[model samples]
Target: MEKTYTRFEHYSGDRTYQNEQLVEQALANSDFDQAATQGKGFCRLLDKAYIFQDEKLSEYSIVIYTLDEPGLLDSAAKREYVLSEHDEMIIHRMAVVRNGQYLDKADDVQIRILDHEEQGGRGFLTNRKKLSLIIKDLHLQDILIFENTLVSHAPQAGLKRDFKHVYQEFPDPFWFYDRYVLRTVNQTSQVMTYKSCFFRDAQHQVIDPIAIDLPIGESYVFEADNFTTDYDPKLEVRPFIDFATKASYSKVSDAAYQIYEKVISQNSTWLETSAPDLLVELAQHETLDEKIRFVIEFVQNSIYYVYDAEIMDGHEPQEPQITYESKQGDCKAKTVLLKSLLDYLDIASTCVLVNYEADYFIPFYCPSPSNFNHVILKIAYQGRHYFVDATSRNQFGFLQYRSVPEFMYYLPIEPQADLQFREPFWHQNYLVEETVTCMVTEGVGQIDHTLLLRRQNADAIRQMFKNESETYLFNCYTTSLYYNMCLTDNFSEKELSEYFTDSKIAIVSDNQDLNELQIQHDVTLLKPYTVRIGKKEYLNYWDRTYLDDKARDFNSRDLPFWLSHAREKLTFELRTDRKINDKEKVTLQECKIDSDFLCYQTTKAVDKHGARMTIDYSVKTNAAIKGEELANYLSSDKKIRDNNFGMTIDLFEQGFFDKLKKSFVKK
Candidate 1:
């Protein structure tokens, strides 16, 4: 079991390996320990890849050698391969080797094929098949080696499939001993581009591949040995790495637009048909915004989203009529339907592809149709461009939805249009205004709260109110009261609904120009404003700043933080029956912090009977706070925190015995 030599070797042509000498050579040149622990087992040796290219076919072969421990028997015993018909890729060979001997026994291996549809999940229809294998008699310290080959058929005319962009990492971080060799041959007339870089030290250093022109075709080779190390915390927030190779296209967007064109051309016939009666009726609204909203809502709510990856043919979208008839489709289908609806209304709209995740790496990689995962509709109306995601059921205000991140890149699929990355306009006019009125009577308190939300905030709140169930809404309010406000008493579902219904105010008003939604509600607490300590009663008002938690310890973070541009105002009015002394009044003060990135203000007023406090806060920037700006941002945050954005009052009630004692002491 103590065989010391391990090596891996791959040849360019149809040559076959004779023995284990290649594996020994690879192990001798590297500092990899074969017996080291790597998760379940050690991948002690890797003769990774042997690729052969021609004008019509591209073939790839990979061989992996594993040293299994007691717990890692299954790791070397089972394997799975994914093959797709759409890519015209197939597995040509698979086998297992043990020690220095090939496992030629048929009883030692089992193979099974499963269609992706039978796997049961929601995703793009890949039309892929899985080949699974299980090997028996796998034991500890066993060198289990397996080899497989894949051949990709040449793509048909007008369909660009020769675009090869291969990204492989050598000396994999998870493998105790790993090696890689990638060789690519371009048999076609198209020029091939290849690039490679070491992970840590190769910043801004470009390494060009050495290309050799053979009698039949050209070949490009790349080899690397990667070592892992601790990275700077600031590097965590850096943009994605631009490392990839592409052939047959100059720009990444060019390849992407070609795929988009194919998909759009195949589905454009659906737009020529007439609109459905329901859509026709909905489109008869007086304003363009109304018609747009009606169509968006219908598509978002009426159709179900089901992604059948088994039947999906590459990036092509299904016909709009098919989606409408089936009442189910993925993002592409929904976007196609939405675009068709816009076509019927004579509105200019296009399908735009976007990556919704905040930390997407597609921008740095070689551009291909696979980069985008989500599709949204972009419309030009009233001299403005608006982006709409019809796949989402909860989005409101069409273009003013706040859930969509600002400054994300998007690709619009349109003919004669520049295929470049673009960003949506950053909206900053959203407002959230809250007013609370409190009254105390006989140790109990009644609180009335009113909120006016405008623009993006209004849309979000409206969608929440519309979609959430009554029980869910009640739970949300009760949870907030209990955790944030320290209100322990709970209300039943019926009682909570009744309280909401009684205190709810209508949205009607004379100011028809206003685009804000007004919500008013009232709640009664058993002992809302005071906590008794012996004979004295202390006021229990809590600080109400929404951003207090975010401001706490923000300076300690190494990465820049993102602050969405928004304006918020909160007002509170307090009234109590207890006798109030002049000195007992809450202090009246105004605090303000103004910077290029943020603006904040807080004002307080006190009267003989009650007091009122108002706070105005706004973020002026929508970017990350880094370097010197981080200090300024933290300064503003500290000012807001120190001013007591949610400061509570420290008022106590004096008893008759305490007043008499004070009077006697004064005499």
Candidate 2:
């Protein structure tokens, strides 16, 4: 829209964005019918551009929202954006368009900067901030413009010029149109090339960004005007485009390995200074597998996970000696330490890079360290390769049976390689088995819940046991049972504390080597049958939501539901110590629902005397669910939710209840 775009030339700080021409252009393109169709505040403009000037990549975005109704004024005061501590954000423009005149509010606006540590509890300590701007006195049909540019700084020391992997965000989830453009000027010695994935050309074929060769100072204006998005844009893997000088995936692998090799060589004391105390424990075990297990255990447990903005994280591991002395490192440092110990023990192992979120689409991404977000050690022993993540603390046992993230693709740090399809190596079992048993004695019911967890869930529970107090754990169990039994989301602290007065929890069994954990949660309720009378409903244990939310990610016609990520199954057993002689209520029927997303099968079994009722629900993970099959899948999901697993129990014999009170009183 402007010649030269000189404000973006040197990338300073806090420049007010002004482009009235571009704003008018985008507003003219905005459709009123689409805006009315959405029935919400319509977005007039969403112009995002990536201007790569050699080693630096600065993203300039200008989003303008038109408040169509007075109701949307509340949202106007809540305009805020997050900024990384290291990066610089430029508030280019802040203005409002009314009656074809711009009210310049940039100079007078008072924006509050807040400490936005939303996920600090999850152990991720990123120094990011949230800036909130207040727009006062907003009216109907007023177009508010917010323009800013974020100058992204490279993560760390080694890869300054290496433009490896970059994630591009998707269009805003509005019914309006947006623009995505990329402009660059290569002012370096390296040849500049770009690769993008997931975008389709006019022929409906997957567009390959590898073939795109941009000359010096070339401007790439990617047009996506008529595109419509129905699914959550956050979950969608938007066009993943990155610039890299490397020719192929093989070259990219070679470059990465060379960097690692050089770093290891520079810090060769890790190999020469003899094994540390943590690694020396491997000598106590005779077998190679035992020694490998010891090494893995030492790195996993000894070194706690600390997150840094490690891009494969910053693409370089800390010096092994530093990591060992500190006993804390990110995924890259931990894996490097584990690999070093394996080398000391004369074991053959290598570090692998993978992306848990992208799963299958990783193969389509350009070969760069940025495509991979996690690192794990892959041990080659006894004619097979077993992957183990150093960040995982609670996993135990031999290398083969040990659990790992189900990333569908992995790239090993070798001389040359491509993204290889990873097959299942870890043993698969029921991740969780929940047994809810209710027994009544003297008009009081004791509902005992035994949870048997394996693998990933086992690891999670072990963390809870280690970190949380017994009282906290007991309260958690009580809260869970209260929610499931009552089937309500509404919670009052006063009532919850008063309810479940005699709740107790105990760790029945915990075997770390086998990766199994079992806990019991029991609560005594007074006349629970009276409160939950006539066809008591129970949730299907794991799938408790009203509808399957994962099904919505594949809402688009092109993207498929990534099934490799959904590898765990839940087995729930519900029982009651009461007789159910009614043939209609206890017919012992087995129901099965097969859909493209998942297969759900449930069975009801009763004892010979009909004294106890046990209902079981089971589902096995399958392949990816394509979008075309989502309708049938959603129908099955709706069917399961609509019929909320009702179980009718005979609390009393016919006419026995009415005679009890009268007979006892008169005699």
Candidate 3:
């Protein structure tokens, strides 16, 4: 593969042959009347067409563009397209329009095909590669034109193989990209259907998907002009049409389910050899949930995640015995094995396909096997079923307690199963529980912080300890200690590092019976009283910097924020031996806030020797807030924040005068 792309000016692929006559026809049909923007580079014409023929879908595209400035040369020359091993791309023509003439450079264009090395580190055993088209001598004011076609070699004619994707806007800031047409010709006789999803346009208005049935010949066509670039990362609705054959949803679902069952049935000898040992191991747990936990751990910890090229191709999963014996499999492979184990235990479980990232949009899509990108299992333990990812590691708990992916929509492999939805709920009470105790002993502040993590937080931190050392943990906490002990903006960088370097952190406990991780961190502040620029130092509270910092990340965005850090509860307490209260009877100030999705409260009390301000904060819900509800959430946050206590300091200024009087006599 490397050798094929080593030569600079040659074709990188031998799979697709070029047709000159077809290329000329495509170019001649791409004439645009709209004038290009004068100052910037822009695409004058783009023609993308798809043909569903002979049980396969082929994609062909033609693009013509020009650049006026030399600044756009690098970007113009380095145009690229990502391709997987299952997909083939062929370039039919490449030429430049110089003086109203086509200077053909199709054979001499520089081409480079590079494989993805980073995917290996992410545990996605993929043969995905990139194809780069490096046009040589790409100069100013010269129109560059190219034609290409793509086809997937995967078995699309089988049980699950139809899809349609659409884009209303481009990513590039082209001056004029409206001269574009996207067409699909269904050469097959099957009647394909598609659904509509609305997109938000530049004026903040919704653009509903245009559903146009193909001509009487049943060919679907979509054409658009003046497509603008969408810059918001949160805006992610891509209008699409579905072209799956009018096959029944249940039929497709059952066909895929049968393949999984067949793999287990044909490999009966595997169970004969492997089941007895697994059963003997499962028997040690004595309880059903524990037995299930054992099997899940066995798959997660024992079977490694290695995504082969065949993953998610709607193909048959490997035999359970094979995955169990090899201790390595993709999402589908590990999931099938886990499902088999549950089956052997007389536990009912089903396979689910999800897009781990954008699962929230799954139910909106038409029924098709091509929608999902990842596979997991939904186990029925006790009386309920919840998702469990086989590719996850170090996750241990009951079904709901396990820290699994926050999946929204799923397609079950059960017979007649349509799309399924998972309500956004945190099965466990607390994703993270932490207690910060500040003790003022002998005129110094000794802070003790203990964190108890469950669910996803626990699993994540456990892996942190597995991959990082205690020293690394302390370095991370140093920043936290700095912000907690001193006013953030009041201290210099050197002062922060000098004062907080003495912090100590240790993983006090881990996987306590493989359930949760408990960590302890301690920091001692020698000069707890410090008001910058004053030799007389003092303690200050109500910094509110941390609260403002967290809110700043979403101050202006309208995207439905993904709430991964929700369901966390934290408590901070301060204690000291000094006498500051005048009498035994003292007053306490408190503010309680209960919002739509969270609860927060702060209490301040002064003892005889010292004062303590305790803040209890928790995000109660896991559901994401839609854009319409964002302003209300922010308003509620403001109400809670505004009730905060004013910044207060100890009687440090008065003590500073006492220290000066005692300094001359004591020395």
Q: How far is candidate 3 from the true structure (C-alpha RMSD, Å)?
A: 5.5
Is candidate 2 or 3 superior in TM-score? 3
For model 2, what is the alpha-carbon lDDT of residue 199?
63
Model 2 residue 530 lDDT score: 30
Which digits, one per residue and each the tens of the lDDT, describe model 3 over residues 424-494? 65334666677776676555778888989887778778778789876677656656656555646556645
Cα lDDT listed for each candidate = 0.55, 0.61, 0.63
Provide the RMSD of all predictions against the true structure, rounded to 1 decimal. 7.5, 7.4, 5.5
Give per-residue CA lDDT, model 2, range 1-667, as digits (tens). Answer: 5111112132243323446664564457544436645664355556666666545567777767677765666777566777665456666676778887777666656667676664442246555677667776667777787676776665444554465334564455455554333344444345556666656677655565554666655555555654454444554445556655445677767777877886554433554464455545655788876777777888888887777652334577776777778888888888988887777766788888888776666656556666777888888887887778898876776676566566678888888887677643323555667667666543455677788877667778878888899778867776665555553433454466565658777778987666788988778755344323454422223235324667744455556665433233333333343444446443344456765454555555555222333323333343455655656766776666654343434443426755686468667
lDDT of 1 by residue, 300-404 (tens): 878777665533324457677788778889887888888877776678888876776632344444544445566788888878777777777644454433244
Name the TM-score of candidate 2: 0.69
Cα error, candidate 1, residue 457 (Å): 5.0
Q: Residue 464 lDDT in model 3?
A: 84
Better of 2 and 3 by lDDT: 3
